[model samples]
Target: MLSAGPTPRVSLDTWEFVIAAENGTEHRWSWQELMALPQETPMVDIHCVTHWSKLGTTWQGVSLDTLLDGVDTGAHFALAHSYGGYTTNLPLDDLRGGRAWVAHTFDGAPLAPEHGGPARLLVPHLYFWKSAKWVRGIRLKTMDEPGFWETAGYHDYGDPWREQRYQGD
Candidate 1:
């Protein structure tokens, strides 16, 4: 379990995730709103840059494609921001289609705070760090911007299969 800062206490009544785009368009969704969307349980393997891998983990949440539906943007990349100020960057392509999810449940139960509770971005195909925990929003941009770890020496695009961990790995 890794965290950027103290865990945030969120209330279902006031908590909402905001998606902001460079075009000045922003969309907000509450917990109930998100749950109302089509959900899926995907069994995926997660690899951490710290040299650990967890396979066949099941997660349930709304697909990024679903949340992004009708959102028009020419951005080529996205920056995932978390409650505790953690952020990660990825190509917009990595989040489209069925490639990513905003997961709220794990192993058939509500996600625990220690594991990025309320909701977390799950991009299983990339290194686990790219799956920003405590995810709160996504900012789309036309140009690439290195995120927290990326600016701190981690690779800007963390593709696990390619072992892109460090800046030049």
Candidate 2:
């Protein structure tokens, strides 16, 4: 598992996930509330910006589509925020459909903190960095906003297939 800093030991009692819309509306879900939502097991391939690829990894979580079902938003971009202040940007479209999940289980086991336990944003189609770990919320944005890595020269839209690892790549 890769992380930007020391693993954060999060307590379930205080864990919550949120979705902030461009209109200033915030939808929140506590750990229990989140687990009560519909769950899906997705087997997908993940690629890292470092050029490593893992195929057919299994995970269990709620689909982002399910989470955004009734969310009213006109935003075309999204900025994912995570615990420990890590963040990443993605086109809102990339998070819809069945493309992404807020994963809490891996290989049928509770995800380890080092692996973004509690929950993490899983966008398998993009580079792994685009999948923010320990994801707490996503802010819908009318304008594309770059996040942690993006601001530090990483590609704003990281697509592993396109080799978009750097700002100009």
Candidate 3:
């Protein structure tokens, strides 16, 4: 588990996941509420921009589709925010249609803090960096907002299969 900043230990009591729309409306889910949502176990292949890959890994969580149900948004982009201030951007379409999850378990066990415990965004179709660790919320925007690594010269959309790593790659 690689993180750009110090790992944050989030207390479950205060943990919450939010979806803020471009229109300023918000949907909030506390840890308990989130756990009560329908859970799915997805075994997928994850790739990292750093040239590593994990195949058929199992994860348990609510689908982004399920989480976004009833959310009203006219946005075309999404920025994932994490507990440690880490963020990543992705096209809104990339987050829907069963493409992503707010994952809390791995390998049949609670995810360790070192591995982005509490919860993380798991978008296995994209490079792992797009899967924000310790994910706290998602901000829907009408405009594209390049995130932390994107501003640091990493490709705005890191696709391992296409090898979109560096800004010019």
Error of 1 at 8 (Å): 2.0
lDDT of 3 at 151: 84
Q: What tens digits encode model 1's per-residue C-alpha lDDT throughout 1-169?
A: 4566788766678768888888999999998999999999989999999899999999999999998898888899999998878988999999998989999999999998879878999999999989988899999989999999899899988888899988888
What digit string (tens of lDDT, one per residue) describes model 2 on residues 1-169?
A: 3477897878889999999999999999999999999999999999998879999999999999999999999999999999889989999999998999999999999999989987899999999989988999999999999999899899989888889999999
- TM-score of candidate 3 relative to the true fold: 0.97
Instruction: List where candidate 1 sits over 4 angstroms from the true fold.
Output: none
Local accuracy of candidate 3 as per-residue lDDT tens digits, 1-169: 3588789999999999999999999999999999999999999999988778999999999999998899999899999999989999999999999989999999999999988998999999888989999999999999999988888888888878889987888
Candidate 2 segments whose C-alpha is farther than 4 A from its true place: none
Q: What is the C-alpha RMSD of each candidate to the true structure, in Å?
A: 1.0, 1.0, 1.0
- The candidate, 1 or 2, that scores higher on lDDT is 2
